[model samples]
Target: MASRSRLHVAVFLAPAVLVYTAVMIWPLFNTLRLSLYVEADGVRSFAGLANFATLFGDPRWSEAFWNALGNNFWFFVVHMLVQNPIGVALAAILSHPRLRFAALYRSAIFIPTILSFVIVGFAWKLILSPIWGIAPGILDAVGLKALFAPWLGREEYALTTLALISVWQFVGIPMMLIYAALLSIPEEILEAGEIDGITGWSAFWRIKLPLILPSIGIISILTFVGNFNAFDLIYAAQGALAGPDFSTDILGTFLYRTFFGFQLQLGDPHMGSAIATAMFAIILAGVCIYLFAIQTRMRRYQF
Candidate 1:
């Protein structure tokens, strides 16, 4: 019976394991392998770390790489500072005991998350366009017309504007996660807090916040991974070039341009793989830091 049960378990797990290996593990290792090689005049050769050195040493590659890296950092920072806090605040409000139409509000807020990146990007682009957008008219109605600009066109505001649009689309994810975390808190603990004169903001700060640290940490890591891997929205909105002079260029766009070769530039798979490898390293490092430094210190509050 023990041997039969073990066989059954293996049979169940085999398909998933095979699929994961084929789709994820294989591609990842292949990309890493490609990164260690270089091509010259159609002849490929082992280059070891030469490609990486060129990526950082050559001005042509290094300038674009560093610019994309910096933009990616800022993209993540905006999501952390703006998206998570707003999500938390929305979750807190929606979780209120006597709030009316709470279900409707929750559903409405989460609507954007289900929409495609292409739709969100184009929709916002049209709405923000200076030539024929509704945003300027709306701002004019509110007596704030001067605040409006061609946000997606100008280099100064393009990256930040795109980041904000991304934030709007994905805020519901953190809201839902944090909402579930808030709901998991014991009613007895909250009641006891009330008895100790800890209600409203004080109750949230003193009693509830500590328990939800794990959820927040998870959300942060997810945001880090997603932001770093982001491509579709930027591509949809700004094209592969990521212009107005590549102001919104990020690692994903950089990889796309390198891999496929945009107008006037020849595609270089080896260099593209190098960029991918770098991105993987960055994401892995962030996850490791979060797991070791942040997650280890968080106490898992039990009911």
Candidate 2:
């Protein structure tokens, strides 16, 4: 009977595992393999690790590589600082037992997340434009017109502004995930805490927050991966150059530019492959650290 049950489980899991391996795992392995080769004149040659060596040692490649990598890190940091906290706060409020119009609030908050990246990017651009944007006009109405500036066009503010915009659109995901985690906690647990004189903020701090640590950790890792892979928004708003002097340039856009060529620079697949490999390595290291270090230590409590 136990053998039969095991077979049943395998039967159900086999198709998903097969599809995942074929679609995701195989392509990743092939890309890693390609990263070890150099392509010239439509011919492929095994370059061992020379591609990686040049990627770090060569001046032309290293500068953009480091800059994009640094920008990506800051992008992830901004999301952690702004998006996660806002999501948690909203989730907490939404989870309140007596809250009205909860469904409507959830739908409205999540609507932006479901929109295509191109739509969100263009919409924000129009709204932030200097000539006819509503943002400056709204600020003027509120007696803060002096605060308005072409933040998207300035080198110093462009990346930060874009990061904030990305956060605004995506916070709904974390909010929903955290809210669901909160709801999964049994009412008996809250009742027990209340019975012992715990209530409000005190109850949440002592009882709820600790239990949601695992969910928060997952959200953090997801934000890290997503931020590092971000390209569409930056491309749509700032173009492939990530301009106003490439201040918003990140690894994804940089890789794209390297692969396809832009203006004076010729496209080089070998270099692009090297950059992609570096990104994959970075993401792999992060995932390993989270899984083996942080995840091993985190215990989700049962209600």
Best by TM-score: 1
Task: Show model 2 residue runs off by greater than 4 Å.
Answer: 1-14
In candidate 2, what are the lDDT values of residues 160-268, reduced to their tens digit? 9999999989999999999999998888998999999999999889888988899999999999999989999999999999999989999999999987788898887
Best by lDDT, which number?
1
List clashing residue pairs in candidate 2.
none
The number of clashing residue pairs in each candidate reads: 0, 0
Question: Candidate 1 lDDT, tens digit per residue, 145-195?
Answer: 999989999999999999999999999999999999999999999999999
Please report, as a residue range, the 10-residue window in candidate 1 with the lowest summed lDDT.
1-10
Work out the TM-score per prediction. 0.97, 0.94
User: What TM-score quantifies how close candidate 2 is to the native fold?
Assistant: 0.94
For each candidate, the alpha-carbon lDDT, in order, equals: 0.95, 0.92
